[model samples]
Target: MIACPRTLFWIVLLVAACFLAGTTSGAASVPAPADGPGLTVVMDNNYPPFSFRDANGELVGISVDLWRLWEQQTGENVQITGLEWDDAIRRMEAGEFDVIDTVFYSEERGEIYDFTAPYTDVDAVIFFDADLPGISGLDSLDGFVVGANRGDSTVKELQEKGITVRKYPSYEAVVSAAKAGEIVVFILDKPGGVYYLHREGIQDRFHYSAPVIRGQLHRAVKKGDAALVTKIDEGFASIPKAAYDDLDRKWYGTPVAEPADLRLITFFAIVAVLIILLLVVLNHTLKQSVAMKTEELKQELDHRRRADEALNRATQKLGFLNAITFNDLQNAVFSLSGFLELEKSLPADEKTLAYRQKQAEILHQITAMLRFAKNYEDLGMKPPVWQNVSQTFLIAISHLDMAGLRRTITLDNLEIYADPLLERVFLTLAKNVLLHGKTATEISLSCKRTQEGLVLVFEDNGAGIPLAMKEKIFERRFEGKKGLGLFLAREILSITGITLTESGTEGQGARFVMLVPEGAYRFTDNS
Candidate 1:
């Protein structure tokens, strides 16, 4: 069981204060473009594979190696101070460190600090006694006691998801409780969790569950260190891909799994297809039945034909009058605007010219609205049909200028049952990139299989939608940009059963994910 809320507050403050006084207060100033005191970087002392004391008592890990590389790259010296996790946070607030390494991202922390993009991906896993079976995820923890490090995000996330968490002083304590059956399960970041299990020689006593949350590791820099932040970001971007892969090999001490190859992806994709309920509607007997019905209707229609001819004459006269009225009004407006411009060229009063200009602007707006209405009338009027994804994508891209933009598509084998307006969906998406994706260098379309179905991803390497606005961007009458494009695109896709969601990070890029459920998609194979 956890301590009461009030008791936990005092315990945390007391612990932070006790470590604060003993932790060395470094006097280094945050680095600048030139001539600075470098940086004081702090991290938890025992987070192995990130920062920890080796058997030789040498401080080494991914974070240490990165800082060393930064020093070599920029001629900037950095001081690494190791303290308890709680103490590191406290000292950072006291300005003892310019950067905090090995920090996880969260909204609350984001308020006080700026972070570099994730330097490493981290996974949170559930660990249980080895004898326990069927402990795969959070769902398996119900009706069982669980332990968490008192101040960990894993604890907060669990509690927020409505699980009861027994708080321990540290992660090591949580593992001990789980192994002793004091708690049925323990949750922690996988790398550190794996390390402690081995260090305690209890690796054989417990087993790990599938990852609970796949998160990232970021460096937390002071809020105002824009220059230093820029350098940090540049340094990370400069690091070779092989550097991280090699480090993974050294740290995990195993052959790490790479991203699935195309062949394997295709194999698993075939397996994951749950059902193939084609939406095509046809009845073999309907043609013959309709022919017989038409013969019978023909006899009856002879009598009705004369009455229909009379109604047609009346309808044609009314349509002619409507067309005449619309044309006359448009011609009159144009003539009036021409006369007003001619009057303005003469020595006319400024007020009179301004009034004429206002009238012209109103007429222009009316014309624009009329055009919009004309185009809007045909929407959703056509029957939905099977649209070839690659062909439609090619048509949409062909309409764009394609001057400086690059488009990549991998949807060759896919087709979806959607409204013929499906072409407009891709068109609108491309137009959005042109209008708003100022930084985008490329636009891409691709498909991948998920447990639910296939996802059609439209992505651009431009400024991404903020998390706050992910859903808001799709609202029909959102904060007032032309939201109609995406709104109509969503409606068109919905004529079948595809749903779209935006899942990109705020700064990474825009990713529009359209989930096409089981019955909506099929593959075209060339035999």
Candidate 2:
């Protein structure tokens, strides 16, 4: 009976050894499976190429492949589960899973999980509107709201760096928000972001920075799980180099190596030869078509250039003629004003005096109109430029007689993209305060950063504009009542998507706020 029991034990051991050898012939370093329950491996369900559902809804990716290889090598039964990244982490921390992959190593994470050697590196990046200039890295995100995926390691990383990030549910959601114009700046993993950007076909609308943070992805267990850690490490270490490389090639787009077949090579060579022969036959036709298209395009461009030149010449001639006419009109108005003044000195009846006063008022109106025309003629003649706010304000004040009034500017080292007439905007504003701001003692200019963009505030402590005239003050028809400078200022700002609005208490002051849209203003180092 004793011999029989011993023989049965030997038979059982032989069968188990045979099974292990068959499963992992070259992987001797892999430890034998523990006798208890199998491991539960969990990973992100939507992270493509690293573990995501295929079109058929089957879970797949490099992480999935590596785990399966580990299972085979170690002779362990691993039940793999796919969940959203946050849920996966939450469940694993809840003790629902024994292992998790596709996780980045951070100090906070290291405190909760025991990480294995890194399997891959993922770069985190910042993507902003292509038109938003001067944003080179994280330091450039000051005063701007940034968006990111909820529960991502990147969010924590950014928070640690003191960057304020708006969280979305996923990278796809971030891209959708950007497309909807809800967000201008966002963060995401480079590969995933590129995938969604290309899929949405809005890749050209955004610019991304170089890797802001490179997270080494690893498979980890709850902290203090040394047994499981050892198994995972050894299991992966035992995988053949070629097998590991194959996984990378299959999922990460590295080209696969294959044995060359002479038959296949010969067949491709013949096809290439046939293609070349056909190309040679069609080369003359293609060259003729291309040459004709090129010549046609060249002729069209030449015609467009000549037409542009002709239009410019016509514009110049009209301006010259208008200038001459304006000069003649000014001289005539000047002579009329002199005659009216001379008439004023001569004694006249009441009715004649009223007629002479009316004539003088009409002449003054004509002179104001002529001055407006001269200033308005140059509007939009030159392209918009970036002007320093403080410097431009000084220039505008230089052109005005700002005596008896204290001028205050708190604009910092800010700059704006506006038409060259930007100077006219400040000049016109200052002139309005001097002319209309009765009881006004001080004029102040400042800026406030907001979600929509920058608000340039121009305020004055004066009798303030009557509530009724706020909107009408910018109307073209109001030009005769309140001069045309305000109307002209509105037009100049609108050319660059900036808006002007009056928002102040009637008794407090006249507050004109110019809304400078994002991408139209930036702060310098002095700010």
Candidate 3:
């Protein structure tokens, strides 16, 4: 159905050339003709191998041969004329020709042309690009733009089924319209469509489905031309059944085999197989390499295991030795303090009293230093655990005897993973504020979450630390009321990677802000 003009033109030339071989029956067997009526019969040229032209511009096909036989049997000069399907129909409607030898039967056209008794059957089918999946039949044509030859049986058939079709003037026009995106599929008689595709050298470009509409193909004459219709029926009846069989065998005996390029398929198949073999070899090599590396890694881990045990044993011994030695030194200091106390009570002048006082002061400072060392030694000795911040703050404050200090605790369900000495960190902060904030009152504890971490603010409204001394406040043995509380608090927090900084209004209150890193903190849903 998609045959180009040149294709049919060439076919017409070939058929005409067949006539030039001296006579139409020059090569083939046929009964000699006895001329009768010289009537002209017009038909659609688009119906290839049925009623189409050849390379010599001569008519040749199923109906053409039948008409030739009809002329031989009936002794009539049955001249055949070929026109585009649509033009043929228009001319026939205008009575430009006396009769149409090959036309499909439909009720709408019955009003315009009288038809003979039905002959052989023809199928209506769907054709589309071969790359697409085959659609089973008409029921599957929803949403498709179907092309149909104008005035062809396929157009009215598709329309009756409520399917949309773009009518083209000719087969070539339909193909062009489809290629131009006007339609997605085309509808036509299956064999003629396939033969057209073959002639055009585009058989592999398309595929067609089984019959969608099966109808009895009939030849029609002018409306009320009962005489012409009767004559066609007589011609068909006169033809022998064996002659019809012979014609069928001659036209459609051989099946058209699909011309495929097998060499390309074989080349790609070999490449695929080689790539698979290479992957197999590489996989085996990689497995062997991994096994060797794994053995080496096992040996390295064995050496590290022995080294770690030795280091742990040595650390344990050092800790035990330090504990024993510090205990003995503390006893000796206690004994010296007692002896100095007894001697100071016995007797002395002003200079002697001052000398005794100096000795007592030095002993007290030494005791403080020894106690700090003992507490510091255990700071990071224990693994960190999740401790409730509110409970820890309460415990730290309880030990401080904050009866004279008014402070509010706003800690909710917050908890953090930190050393057991975390309690001491808070205790140290409370003790520092009591000793340092001279006019301080109303200390408050609250928290806020930030991009970098969590912040716990311990602040008080007081004549806070001076600007120059803010950073210096946390320095070891700097001029606080006495011991290194702030410095030791920072050291305790650092064991678990928490950081502490002072960021209050210096004149209003001294604020200690502790930033707990991201992974180290989470909130309880109940809070």
lDDT of 3 by residue, 62-158 (tens): 6777777777677777767889887888888887887786677777888888988876666778887553453678877665567888878778767
Local distance difference test scores for all models: 0.67, 0.73, 0.69
lDDT of 3 at 123: 72
lDDT of 3: 0.69
TM per prediction: 0.40, 0.48, 0.42
- True-structure Cα RMSD, model 1: 22.1
Clashing pairs in 1: none
The TM-score between candidate 3 and the true structure equals 0.42
Per-residue lDDT for 383-451 in model 2, tens only?
566788877775566445454577666886899877778878998888888887888888889999999
**Overall local distance difference test of candidate 1:** 0.67
Best by lDDT: 2
| True-structure Cα RMSD, model 3 | 33.9
Off by over 4 Å in 2: 1-37, 254-470, 473-527
Better of 1 and 2 by lDDT: 2
Q: Please say which candidate is ahead in TM-score: 1 or 2.
A: 2
